[model samples]
Target chain A: MTCQELLDLLHDYVGNELVIESRTTVEVHISGCLQCGTLVHAYTHTVRVARALPKCNPLPAAFEARLRAMIEPELKDKPAE
Target chain B: MFDPPPEKLTPEIVFREYAPRIYNIARRMLGNDADAEDVTQDVLLQVVRKLDTFRGDSQIATWLHRVTVNAALAHRQKRANRQKHESAEADDDVLGSGGPVTPGKRWEVGPEESVLAAEQAAIIEKAIEQLPEPFRDVYVLADVEGLPNNEIGEMLGLSLAAVKSRLHRARLRMRDLLAPHFEGKVTS
Candidate 1:
């Protein structure tokens, strides 16, 4: 494969989204091409770093309370005569 | 255990299991604490109201992500409308001014890798926040949430190929945005 084609497939390859036959082709290309190899390595590294972000945004109290208020009436009114 | 049927959408169970993930998706999509919180509330409330209609065609989290993205987009639309109507003023604030910019500064990690990882994540988040809503929504759902292409396609009401195409462009844009930082890391 050419450099552009390899780069285009880099994300899919790193994320394990490629089918076996396609992945084998890409792997073979990377094995011989230093440029494609670096792109894949860096692309994979970037994805890993992005995934490491701290998922830490707690919902606001008022929002939760409002949601509870909206649902409470429904819960109370359900299953009643 | 797997999620119970949608009719049994208990807030306690939902909050216990899915809230964190929901919050993460919202934060990535919206980039603000208040908006993320509002979207999370909206998603859960939506779950409560719409539970009976869920057909269990996809994973519960995938379903929840669809709700979450819709809620976040709705919130953004409302804000945009408000801005248009009032000719709203822009806030002259710097990044990291909203919520805790970093997660768990108290948590430990290997020094060099952690610093590089943190910087890389910040760059990515900024680039992601700048993407137009259509692509941004798909990117967050697919990459950040790590949902399958089929599931993402279902959530967005797109064909699987469409999801893959949008995701590919999103990745390319992200790579371009972060190329500066990957200088030493990538060989070519």
Candidate 2:
């Protein structure tokens, strides 16, 4: 792959989201091109950092109870079969 | 056997299944805890109110995200309108404390990492946040949420080419923004 083409594919490449042939070409380019290689490293590091944000509990246990109560008004008077 | 209509739209089911992903997207889009929680709640409430309309043609997550983006956009609009009317009000009152709430600087790093990694991450988040909505939406969905381009296209109702273009531009812009911190990691 040319430098520009490889650079364009670098995002997907580092995400490991690229197709096999494209990945091979990216690897080939990275093997010989120091500049493209650094770009790939930066992209990979960025993806790692983005993914590493702490996954917190999105809501408390009581939230479900609260949400159920809030939504129940819409369900009132439905035939209780 | 004929079936009776459903008794209720269960927030429990939706919350259990979808809340984490919804919160993740909200955090990325809205960039704060309170707003993300509010957006998450609003999206779930909308789901409950509109469950019957969910014809199930697409994945539930995509439909939920459409509700999310809509709700967030509405909230932003409302906030903007209020700000316009209160242009003379104390900026602190509008901002809810002081000069832009500082984002947490620390990463949940493994015990062995160096300071360089943390600095890189901070730079990257700043860069991601600076991207315009269309590009940021596709970038977060694809890169952060790990969705495929096809699914991202479906979620945003864009063509694959359009998604690719936005994603590429988002990355390029981010690379430029991050160049200072990532100096050794990219060539000019």
Candidate 3:
């Protein structure tokens, strides 16, 4: 597998979506190609960092209050009918 | 595949259960607290009004996902229109820019770097916000929400291949945006 071929398959490789035969070919190529290996590492790290992004902070109290207020009118309009 | 039908949901139940998640998706997509809040309210209201129409054909979460995405997209369109009307020149500049400006902070190589996490998160958030809408949606749903490609495709009405393609492109863009900070950190 050439560098460009490996690059094209990087996403599938990282995603584990490649079939066994193709996966083996890419792995063999990456294992020997320093540049391609580094590229894969960086790509994987990029995914890891993105996945590690801070979880969404809880909604602000003020915003929650506002949301409740907004819902109240709707609730009132439908009163247990 | 015979799965049990989704349970009937009440407005209060939907609000209590889904509000936080819905708000999170909106915030990530809209990149503004106020706009996200508005979307949350608008989408929840939509759910309440349309509850009777929900036939249990899909999970409640999937239904909410569709509604929230639509509402967020609409909100974005309205904001874009208003900005365009207010100042065509400003709109042109913002629209013309491919991505947010690279963060100004320089990277260093040690314990001092711990302080940079918050800034790094902010920069990533901005970079995400700058992604074109379609890619942004897939990235947030896939990477941030941890949804599978199949579910993302179902939610976005895209094919599985399309979801994977968009996600790959989105990840590559995010990597480029963040490469400066990760320099020296990633190695062979």
Candidate 4:
């Protein structure tokens, strides 16, 4: 496979969406070409770094209070089920 | 974190159980607490409104996720309109359309051996922030949240093909952005 062709399929390869034949083609291409290999390494590494970053959490208590204040009235105003 | 059955679900119960998930989605997309709060509040209120006719659904988490994504994307569009010309060039300038890629730098370190240093995380966050809006949306949902491609497509109102295309380009952009900061394994 050409370098551009490998780049085209790189995302699917990483996502595990490629079929066995396509997967093998990508693996073979990456093995021989250091440049393409670098792209693959960097590509996967980028995803790993991003996934490792701590996600936002706890939902901020003060804001949760404000949200509850808004929604509570709506629920209260509704006739009891 | 279990709660009442769907038929018995209350807005309070939802807030207690799922507010953090809703707020987390918004916080990641909007990139700031202020906007995140605004969208989260709106989604929560909307859920309460829908809960009036609340027939039990087996997958509240999936449904809630769809709601959160739509609200966040709408908020982003409004913000973009208000602050027109924030991005100087087109998205194409930032995202290559599967063009020939020349490998310049090799960030060859294996991730499994590496620890997540806070500084590296901060740099990655900044790179995410710099991505064009469309790419950023797909990247955040697919990579950051680890949602399946089909679900991300549904949430973003994109076709599966479009989702794949944008996501791939987004990763390339991210890889380029971060390569400078990471030392190659062979920097011996």
Candidate 5:
């Protein structure tokens, strides 16, 4: 695999959707190529950082209060089902 | 012994536990707190009134996920003035074919620095928000929420191929946007 071929295959490799033969070719190419290796590493690192994003954004105090006010009446009146 | 699902489903539980999660999903999707708060409130009101809808067969978390996605998408639609910013540089993907990635420009940051990336949350969030319309949706669902691609395609009414394409583009865009921060910062 040349550099462009490897670049074209980067997404498939990152997604783990590449076939084994194609995968090995990519691995072999990057194994010897420092630039491609760093590119691949940085690419994977980007996805990893995105995955590590905080899963919860806490409701601000005023927003929480308003949300409570909006729902409290319905919770009191409606029979849940 | 496990508490009955009913015992666990209370207004307080919804407020204390699920609300933050719903807000987070909306915040990421809407890219702003005001819009997120609106969708969060909308979903919470609906959840409290019909809390038992998912009581028998489905788990509350699963149901909330669907509801939150739907609500956020719908809420974004109501504000449908989002300009088409499909950047001209869509072809300018990171490390694209025939693009030269010189060694001097490659990221020197290693995997161990991932923990520190969280401290750069402002940049991360801005990069995500900058992603043009629909690609942002797929990126959030796949990378942020960790949802399966098929599920994301279903939610977005896109085919599997479309989801894959959008996600790939989103990742490439993200890499280019964040490279300035981490690149050449050889963290020891």
Candidate 6:
């Protein structure tokens, strides 16, 4: 695979979404080309950092209380038999 | 994972268990706290009213995921339309330009910079907010929320190949957005 090809496929490659044959070709290319290898490393690092982002903040207590109040009547309705 | 029968799910239980997760997804998807809360309430209320329709065909979590995604997307669309009507100014620039990506010089994160995880996370979140809607949804589902591509396709009504393509483009854009920060060229 050329560097450009490797760059294009880097996302799937890092995510392990590429088919085995295509993955092997990109792997071989990265092992041989320093520039492509660095680029792949950078891409991998980017995904890792993005995935490691903080979990979403918890729902606010006030909002939760309001949501509960809004839905309480519906919750109390009898279900269809 | 097995879900309890639909009849067994109480609103209180659902709220206690799933509200935080749904809020998180909406918050990330919409990039605003108020909108996220609105989505959380909308999805939870819909779940309450429609609980009887949920057969045991899928896990409750999966069903909730679908509901949350749909509600968040609808909210985003309404907000966009409202913004358009409220201002005569064409806000085309608010959507990203997908500009040319130049790989920055300092591509690799060195050991000295390891402490910047929180800062990097903030930058990454901002970058994600700037991604176009199609790419943003796939990226957030696959990368941020760790949902599989097939599930994301189902959630977004996209084909598997389309999901992969959008995800690839999103990741590339994320890398480009982050390069300048890592290179110390852009300081927040």
Deviation in angstroms for B138 in model 2? 1.0
Candidate closest to the true structure, highest TM-score: 5
- Candidate 1 chain A minimal-lDDT segment of 10 residues: A72-81
DockQ of 1: 0.26
RMSD of each: 8.7, 10.0, 6.6, 3.8, 4.5, 5.4
lDDT of 2 at B163: 76
Candidate 3 lDDT for residue B6: 46
Give the CAPRI rating of model 1: acceptable
Candidate 4 per-residue lDDT, tens place, A1-81, comes to 999999889988998889999999999998999889878888888888777765545777788677777777787876346
Which regions of candidate 3 fall more than 4 Å away from where they truly are? A54-56, A77-81, B1-13, B50-58, B83-120, B186-188
Where does candidate 4 clash, by residue pair? none
lDDT of 3: 0.70
Residue lDDT tens for model 5, A1-81: 788788777878998999999999999998998878877887787788887777766789999888888887887786433
Q: Give a tens-digit lDDT track for model 5, residues B17-50.
A: 7789899888887889999999998888888878
lDDT of 4 by residue, B1-188 (tens): 11334566776677776777778767777788888888888888877777755557756667777888889878877887888956422264467686687576677456584457777777888888887878888888888877888998888778999888998998988887888887465632
- Best prediction by lDDT: 4
Rate residue B40 of model 4 by lDDT.
85
Indicate whether candidate 2 or candidate 6 has the larger DockQ. 6
The sequence of per-residue lDDT tens digits that candidate 2 reaches over residues B1-188 is 00122344344455555666666677676666667777877887676666656434344655666677667656656665777852222121221211111211222323234243555556666777786666777777776666678877876667887777677666655555655654542223
Best-to-worst ranking by TM-score = 5, 4, 6, 3, 1, 2
**Most DockQ-accurate candidate:** 4
- The i-RMS of candidate 5 is 4.3
Q: Residue B127: error of model 5 in Å? A: 1.1
**What's the C-alpha lDDT at position A14 in model 5?**
93
**What docking class should model 2 receive?**
incorrect
lDDT of 4 at B173: 84
* lDDT of candidate 3 over A1-81, digit per residue (tens): 777777678779998989999999998997897666656665675566566665445678998888878888777765423
Better of 4 and 5 by DockQ: 4
lDDT of 3 by residue, B19-83 (tens): 77788889998778999999999888887777666545466666677788888878887887888
